[model samples]
Target: MPKSLAEVEEGRTVRIVDVVAGRGAAAMLYNLGLRPGARVEVIRSGPGPVVVRTEGGTFSIGRGLAFKVLVEEEE
Candidate 1:
């Protein structure tokens, strides 16, 4: 099942399914190398920013924004 980035477990890799954030937030994430089809590894998850690693680099997404990024586990 698809889950929000904020809900992904640490050490798991997931593919971005959709970003439900506002235009500004979505644009910001896009610039940060997060978008549909991008593969990201969850480095941390919980009551703080969600840290994810992508080919571009690592980034810490605020909890609110992280919840807006929907993802699915990669096979």
Candidate 2:
């Protein structure tokens, strides 16, 4: 099922299905090594944004942006 990144609890992994296209969204996310099929774990969430730990590194994405990152969760 589809869910927001913020909705994903910490320490859980999820496969990235799609990223919302924007002026530089793809490139930006790509720079972080966030591509389709990539798995990411939610490190922390709350306050202003959600933090996800990826292979490339850690990135902080706001709730709005996190919502755009469609993912299929895996338990």
**Against the hidden reference, what TM-scores do the models get?**
0.96, 0.84
Per-residue lDDT tens digits for candidate 2, residues 1-75, read 877676787788998888876859878887788877789989987667888988888888888888888888986
Worst 10 residues of 2 by lDDT: 1-10
Task: Report the C-alpha lDDT of model 1 over 1-75, residue by residue, as the tens digit.
Answer: 898999999999999999998999999989988999999999999898999999999999999999889999988
Model 1, runs deviating above 4 Å: none
The lDDT of each candidate is 0.94, 0.82
Q: Candidate 1 lDDT (Cα, whole model)?
A: 0.94
Q: Pick the candidate with the highest lDDT.
A: 1
Clashing residue pairs for model 2: none
